[model samples]
Target: MKRYLATSAALALASGSAMASGLDRTGQPIGIIFEEGTYAEFSVATSSVDLSGNDRATTTVGSPGNPFQSATGDVGDRFNMFGAGYKRDINEQLSFAVIFDQPWGVDVNYPVGSSLLLGGTTAVADSNAITALLRYRFNENFSVHGGIRYQEIDGEINLAGGAYASIPGGTYNIRVDKDGAFGWVAGVAYEIPEIALRAALTYSSEITHNFTTFESYTAGGAATTTETKTPQSVNLDFQTGIAADTLLFANVRWAEHSVTDLIPENFGGRDLIDLDDSFTYTLGVGRKFNENWSGSLAVIYADVDGDNLVSPLAPTHGYEAIRLGVQYTQDKMKISAGIRYTRLGDAIAAPGGAVGVANFRDNDAVSFGLKVGYSF
Candidate 1:
């Protein structure tokens, strides 16, 4: 049952992408603390996205609205994520784990020298985090875990096109130096080992970053400081054994992204990225075919609430996805592989919170993941 549960989790993690609720990538999982004995694992995932859109006739000025601009030509770029963790049991009742993961990111680039409204616009963001956690078992049925996370983030953005004509040359750029901050995590779990049932609730506090920023435009450039907060989130993970060699699992996650505002002083206090709060739900089933093989399938969904207006830097809203995974175990070594496909909701790119300037539809992405684990 435990092996099946682990396979389900790996499949779900493989499906994670930047298109998730807000800027989520890895889902900040801490399941290593629950592993039996000493365990170690490493995992990696790569995602390729196909996202493009067309400029609206309304974007062009002083002409009949007949000839609209060409397509944006796959603005979404390919990205990869890596994670590793080591867990050790201190005693019968206490355990600790150290984990590393790339938690959040974004990479977008429009073709240069194109007729599209947002041609030549680009944005790249990166983040890395390390977490140390301790878990203590109160009895066979209850346990608690808490941790501290140290994270660093950095990014740069370039805006182009007539939409940004307010700038000196219809272009603007900003680069933010990497910054580091600390946050905390806490969670509790209840389990009934006989039936393989467990429920865990986790809370992750927000981390604030203060970055030294350089802003430039056709008119001038300036060096300034900016502050931004990553969203706080809550996760509920539940699982149970449904029948012999079969398990059921589900998860619910919420992120408060409305408060994660990036308003640089040099940018006239306009929030560069505006995101709404989000909720993500997942359900899956796992089956063990034999002693050494298992497989799982899962579905993920998030609602857009009928709002399609979005930032050009991070376009798209809501999502629906399907994930499939297979695992092999022999002795103390285990290997897992999974794949996911996501359909991104349509969106209208609105710069500076204004009316729509472009439409993005029929976009999607594919992701692949592999994980290796060893227990001693």
Candidate 2:
């Protein structure tokens, strides 16, 4: 009787499989694909952040600092994606499925030297991707999977020396252009029918980004260029259903931004300014009120500390966020929407802290998404 009771409890804990769909900061989903099905999905999201007014002048420079310099601005961005997939049944005890999706990235603009340009442009780090996955089911309760990823990344860095539409001239422009690189991922999962519970563990391998940049000289002459590659990252997620109407999920991710050592290859590396590794964590609960609707709330934290800071013009430090999401499903179709409020951390003053430099602070965003899936 005691053994049977213990087994029953364990099954209960595994009934409602908890799933971690996306990261709170980058706002990327985690789940892969539906079982033995084909579907199409689309999503659109947006965000806004405001900076704090801390004197950006360095004490070492002995320069009179300008107070009340605000880095607050509008950073609205969006994403568009479309994918189709299928799941195949091998036998009663074995099955296979394939899925495709677009992963992570960011595109943002800030005031150049406290002055907003008509473009209000400063720097841009852009990224995009396409992923294909295959999964095998061992039985009614267990399975494993793996996949490949191809990605494209590029960016531009504009320093406070030249003039563009709204800001002063003399700023520096470091332009980065890249093609693509390949990566991989693998994971396992288990399901318990007795209590409607399930659990899964997934590992996403890092994909390297190789590219080139042209450095614009403030003095004169044409642009000088160089080549380099950005580092990779690892993501892990675990989810479970704790109640008939409630599910819990958590995720952890590690990113090596330090791998990015130079902008324009000809300029060489910046020893005094290099980025370090970063770790992010997320936890949330999903509640299903009825058969057709559900809602979720999650909190996230990131520790972006570095003994060596990169991009003297940008920000350094970890961030935190609170995210809320809701989903509606009706006969082969599901729609999801989410909003997040973020608090960017603080950074130490560097050589470029003078002029209108300010500590980074912005964590406001609003997002909406729609996905339609069909089972075979």
Candidate 3:
């Protein structure tokens, strides 16, 4: 009974990976960290952001804004993702696992016709991580787990349109393809099979990358090199059985993004993109119906902390989201799916400080996910 119930709760969490809040593309969830026996799972998800406002550019660097060349409408991007994990128990007290994820990322592309100030301005960050972990069970209620990770990141940026008519080549374009960096994760977990309760605290070290990059301002510009790191993070996950066949779960995550600097010297030494330390919280409840079905609903929130001078690259501030998920199990396999809706908080965006746009409020997004798991 305890084993099946735990599977149900985990399945619900996997399904709930439909969307993440803030500029967080990967929720960095540890739901799969508790899987039992020899198990494997695969998941895919997608999200659409409707980020659009105004193009605040001036006639020159320190001049007043131009009202005639303004543009408006949606300029957000649609993202697709996938991940996989595998875990094997070596014995009653030992286990090993491997997990793959696209941990930290970004995608920003203003429409070519949206506004003269931002038209053709774009940026993207692509990353992938692999983690190999080992776990040891010390009795019926306590355990320890630790792991090492390898990740690679690559990105590109472009600045064009009427806003950049003053640079060395009237525009800026840079690209970075970085080598893998090593990181570590360590955690302790306490579980009570009698009450079907589990609590875990995990910390992940920062992974830095030294990118071999190229840059250009015009047709004859040369390339440059730089380095950057994704912030270190901590996650706490807890779940307990409160009623017959029902479970309650909660998670809190914090990332040290406030102190990490990502400005490359080739990019004018200005911080192109960053976040105020990020915090996300989640609460959910799941119910098992019979032996082959279970479902859950959850609420998620993340606050936009720090200075409010928003970067157009990362426009949305904070967000509140609602998610629903369901799973179906047959024999040794389970399939799960979920949908989520998020209400993004408001903020102001302006580059160059000459002219800017406020009221990036009331924005929203919808996402969907699917997961398949099998046990041996």
Candidate 4:
């Protein structure tokens, strides 16, 4: 009947969102509330990305001839992500849930022996979020949910090799230790149980964090306090049972990524890491094959509209991804496994005068995920 429960399999495939636009590592979905009865789920995802390019500097101008060769090797790296959540119905008209996810992150490492332009450069960022939500239904068709969220973030970036060579230290290590922030979420939904039809819209508030930014040079280091706000986002999620054993689902998300600018004092208070806004969408269908098996197929798309410069830290632009998953329900436990493949967009590594840069073309990734759930 309600085979769409298998959507969890598809959701697991997206857990590697640490590879999403603008250093977005997690999609932070609220799908757990969709479950009927009491349910708990845990998942792990891993992604391997290949983002590399060749040196395009035919001539030298203003330190543009750094990469040296017209051809180079791979620079993009691999990363892993994890998530878990639980949901339960408090009564006929109320439900509660607690969700854990890694909502944002960055991982980029260039080979130390690669082209001079970007060799020996790396940027790593990590974050985690916990949310508690409550939903109340006044009637059969209308319901609302709200929640409080707590998030923590920390990161380190090493700027070295090419252009950075001219700076006093020849290399700058920027580190931001762990910090926490608070935010909120609210949403409304309409559901019709007979056909398993539901449509919900949610808004996530922005969170601000202040960290002690440490800048290390080859010889000395300096520290300063800085503030940054995580981006605010909106989500529209819809799903419905189409036939005896089939279902359809779609999700639309928009995030104010451009607002999360990481600016440090050493860089004239300018955005050391600036990003553009993002709009991502996913569409999929699920089917139940028998009493114990279900499967899902989905396609993901995103439009990353921005101007990106050449840097080893951020490579590739937007992307197109596909996910396939299956879930096996046995007794009191549900197990799901999924795999995703993404074709990343091509772009000029640097916007201008920067030399030894190449067009990051033909980049792609493969991600695999597994999830387990239990209901009582």
Candidate 5:
């Protein structure tokens, strides 16, 4: 019950409102439009796990027909997100905006006495992001923007002896602590007056972190130690207007989740895992029914290629989503409400991956917001 509540809170923080263009605009009213604003804050969150091929009991059998049936375990949890930002108009052609939010994070735990407990994998990742941006409006028909970002990340992991009992000798353990780093980004936008079309492309740079930990490589039940570093990642976001009242947005995120293979520093060198890049796409349309009422609907697809390569550590895959929202504007104040539904696709594992890990079926979410606009 506690875990379910946590997952719900996290989803609420990260759920995006329908038809929101950018977080930096708050001027002229269009229709039932949800223009970008600090809204006093924003957030993103998810707390769930995969139990597909993680069965530990029959791991030694390793058969092609049912290699994943060994994992027989379940994972679930709860989390929350919160942040605040502000934007300013520097002039008619230039503007400035700053934002703070959590873009990447994970938290999971495998209890004692579980069959899949080999290597006792337990991990927690917490992070925060701060960004500064500058925008230039060339004319009513076009504009461009770019920025720099700073990220702070930290994590801890402990692998107990029973954790990797599936491996030959059946006894191994390790502990790790990770450090943070910095990153950057740049982007541009173009607008067409005749069709009221607007488009934007933004790129986020990579960030690296150093990790130090202890390893108990009990060959005959012995011990050891070492230090390591995990590489960062890159992300890209693109958005465009299909018509006067429709918008399309998509994002691609690539990361080196393989950094988990390096284990304790004494294992000679880093053993990089091969986690594939992920993608998410969104499409939405807004209609102005008059001056006081407006509404929108959107759909998004998320694909995280962590199937066979994934573990009890963090399970991810393809999913589909739908969203609906309505906005009311009176004078300079706007009220918005929205709802979303997400579904985790079926499982498809590769050779040598965990088995019987639970498939994250579905989730529903709703959001309410108010924005006050003033133009000088």
Candidate 6:
């Protein structure tokens, strides 16, 4: 039962989330520390998104009489993520682990010349992080863990459209240099191996980055510095044996994104995007058919505020998804694979918080993942 639970949780983690709330990608998991004995794993996931929308007729400037109607084309791009981790037990009560992952990202590209209002617009953000942790078991059922994380991030953005007409040539661009920062993670857990049950609660602190930024338009360009913060988050993970060879798991995650803001000095100090707090919930069950094969199914949901207005750079609002996975284990080696399909909620892209610029609906994404692990 314990092996079945771990396999299913790994599958869910590998599949990841498509267009997760508030730029979240990995959910900053720390489960490897609980693995039995010494273990190591590597995983990869890729997602293809179909997101498109149309320019709002009433919001198109200078076309008051003749409403401008044009399709925005597919703005969301395909992306890939990679992760690795190693865990080792020093004694009966002490353990450690090191993990690597791409925690947050954004990719958006509007087709050029398709939509008069938002043609040639693009935005790309990338991040990489590493965490080192130590866990100390206090008794048969209680344990505490803490860690330090180091992360790096960078991005570039290009804005074009009548909505940005204030800028020369109705185009604006910004590039941010990679920056690194440090943060911390702390958590507590309770386990009852007899019943294959465990509960964990974790907190991740926010990390701040000061990036060198360059801004440009048709006329010229200027260089300046920008400050940004990655949001703090909390996660609750629970699992237990529900039946013979069966395990049930659930997770809840919350992120405080209101404090995370991007205000480039050259852009008149106006925040590039305004994001709200976010919550995500997941539930799943895993069943072992025999000694070598086990399978799992899960559903995921992210909550959205009532407001549909959103930044054009990150257009989609909340999401609903279902994932399916299978695992095979032989001796010391294990392999897992999973797939997820996500239906994105409708949203209105309103650059600078002005609503009715564009309507994005009927968008969705599909993702696949594979992982390999070995125990010693």
Can you rank all candidates by TM-score, best first? 6, 1, 4, 3, 2, 5
lDDT (10s digit) by residue, model 4, range 312-356: 467767789988888888887888888888898776665222442
Candidate 5 least-lDDT 10 residues? 22-31
Candidate 2 Cα errors over 4 Å, as ranges:
1-30, 34-36, 52-55, 59-108, 112-121, 161-170, 193-196, 220-230, 271-273, 307-316, 349-357, 361-376
Clashing residue pairs in candidate 4 (N, C-alpha, C atoms within 3 angstroms): 17-25, 18-25, 64-355, 310-349, 310-350
lDDT of each residue in 1-376, candidate 3, tens digit only = 4765556555555544433433457765555657877898998888887776665545653466545535445656778777888989889999988988887667778777766666787878777888899888999799999989998887887877666666676678878776788999999999988777888899888877777777777656665567676778898888889988888888888887754455666666766665667788889888888788888889889876765556666777777888888888899999888888888767666554334443365678888888899988
Q: In candidate 1, what are the lDDT values of residues 1-376, reduced to their tens digit?
A: 6656666665556445536755678778887788888999999889999989887766353365656666778899999998999999999999999999988888889887653578888889999999999999999899999999999999999999766767778888999999999999999999988767889999999999999999998879999999999989898999899999888989888888787788988777788888878888889898889988888898899764438888888788888888888888899988888889989888888887677777899999899898888998
Candidate lDDT (C-alpha), each = 0.84, 0.48, 0.74, 0.77, 0.44, 0.87
- Candidate 3 local Cα displacement, residue 42, angstroms: 0.7
> Which regions of candidate 6 deviate over 4 angstroms?
65-67
lDDT of 6 at 61: 57
| Alpha carbon deviation, residue 338, candidate 1 (Å) | 0.5
Candidate 5 off by > 4 Å: 1-73, 113-120, 160-163, 166-178, 193-195, 212-264, 267-274, 288-294, 304-307, 326-337, 347-376
Q: Please, what's the RMSD in Å of model 2? A: 7.1
In model 3, what are the clashing residue pairs, if there are any? 215-223
**Could you list the CA RMSD of all candidates, in the order they appear?**
1.5, 7.1, 2.5, 2.6, 8.6, 1.3
What 10-residue stretch in candidate 3 is worst by lDDT?
15-24
Query: If both were scored by TM-score, which would come out higher, candidate 5 or candidate 6?
Result: 6
How many residue pairs clash in all the candidates, one count each? 0, 22, 1, 5, 30, 0
Q: How many clashes in candidate 1?
A: 0
